[model samples]
Target: MRRRDVDTAVRHAALTFGAAIALMPLLWMVSASFMAPGEASTLPLRALPRRPTLEHYATLFTRLDLARHFLNSVVVTLAATLGSLLVTSLAGYGFAKLRFRGRDAMFRALALALVVPGQVGMLPLFLLLRELGLVNSYLGAMLPFFGSVYAIFLIRQYALSVPDDLLDAARIDGAGELRIFATIVLPLIKPILVTLAAYTFMAAWNDFLWPLIILSDSAKYTLPVALASLVGEHVQDTELMMAGAVVTVLPALGVFLAIQRHYVRGIMAGSVKG
Candidate 1:
């Protein structure tokens, strides 16, 4: 083979190998979820189940009432994603386009918050939520996501790339600020918003800490917390645990896959705009 062709072949082989390695655990988890109880822990590790069954998944939905927990996760994740997108996008646009006293200073202070560990503020946040009677509520669970500095920063950076002349033209044509934002700015920044939605969805879906801390009611428990309880109660049920793992991972994976093209484009565009 020619040298360039040989190099291309080697690169593709390496990427394929890396992809397989990365996907192995997920593939195995799906495989094991279909295996009967105790089959996953057999003497010889099997890549595929000898006899695939949905009994574990059935148990998760029926006896364990994981359906409730699954619903809780869905509600919390969707609310958090939508709320975060709206708040962050508006704040970002304001920061990028609107002029006000101490605007730069305020943004700098907000940006400084990104350096602080999220764990550091959970105590005070919980206290505030308690005062507001929001503890153990879905709204409380979602409130924290609406104020993300990183999301605001990303949206602001992307919004900065909006043409000043376009905005000026809109103002001259008798368009109000809200009208221009809804009709012009939003369409221009759609890629970044889709990217943010995907990110917020994944983060909120997989989040265990804040929900666990804020929500005390067992009925209100998110999937991760419910899965943790399952681990404690059914440590020996490997197949069942794998089944729960699949449930926990599948939605986030699906959302990412669905929006992957927009996600990539948004990231590239945001990077260039910033």
Candidate 2:
């Protein structure tokens, strides 16, 4: 074979192998979720369930209190994502557009602070939440994300593209800063807002560590924490664990797939501007 042709064939084989390896775990998880309790672990470990059953799902809803955890995940994710978007967008726009002393230096400091690990502040954050009486509450789960340095940076980057002429016109019309931000800047940055919202939703929804730490009660467990607890208690039940994984993963996957176009666009825009 010609050298170029040989290289193309080898690359094709590599791609096919990599794709199969990546998909194998997901396939196994789905198959096991449908299997009867012990069927997933039988001698040969079948790739497909011998007999599919929804019994595990039924058990999850009826006996395992999965519904409550699902609700908690939803409420915390929505509140955090929305609240972060509003706060970050406003701050970002102000930093990008409004003139102020030490603005650039302060934003740079916040950007630098993003490099610090979240775990470094975990102990202090927990103590603060406790003092505020937010411990074990949904607000406690959502509070840490109300101010996001990365989100502010993203919004400021996007807001920099807004025309100065537009703002000047608004000011000439006697519009205040807040009014201009609400009516003009927001509509112009809708795509980035959607992108940021999707990011916050996915992050908050899949978060395991903070929720696990703050929420001591079973009633307030998010899906990931609840699934971990369930796995501990039901380790032998492979099918049940697989079902829980599916439930935990599906929402984030669905939301990503739905808004993926805008998400990709936002990333591209940020990269080019940077």
- TM-score of every model? 0.92, 0.95
lDDT by residue (tens digit), candidate 1, 127-234: 999999999999999898988888999999889999999999999999999999999999999988988887788889989999989999989999999998789999
The C-alpha RMSD in Å for every predicted model, in order, reads 2.0, 1.6
Total backbone collisions for each predicted model: 0, 0
Candidate whose TM-score is highest: 2
Model 1: lDDT of residue 22? 100
RMSD of candidate 1 to true structure, Å: 2.0
Residue pairs with clashing backbones, model 1:
none
Which pairs of residues collide in candidate 2? Answer: none
Write one digit per residue (lDDT tens) for candidate 2, span 158-259. Answer: 889999999999999999999999999999988889988877887898888899989999988999899998989999999999988888877777888999
Residue 98 CA error for candidate 2 (Å)? 0.7
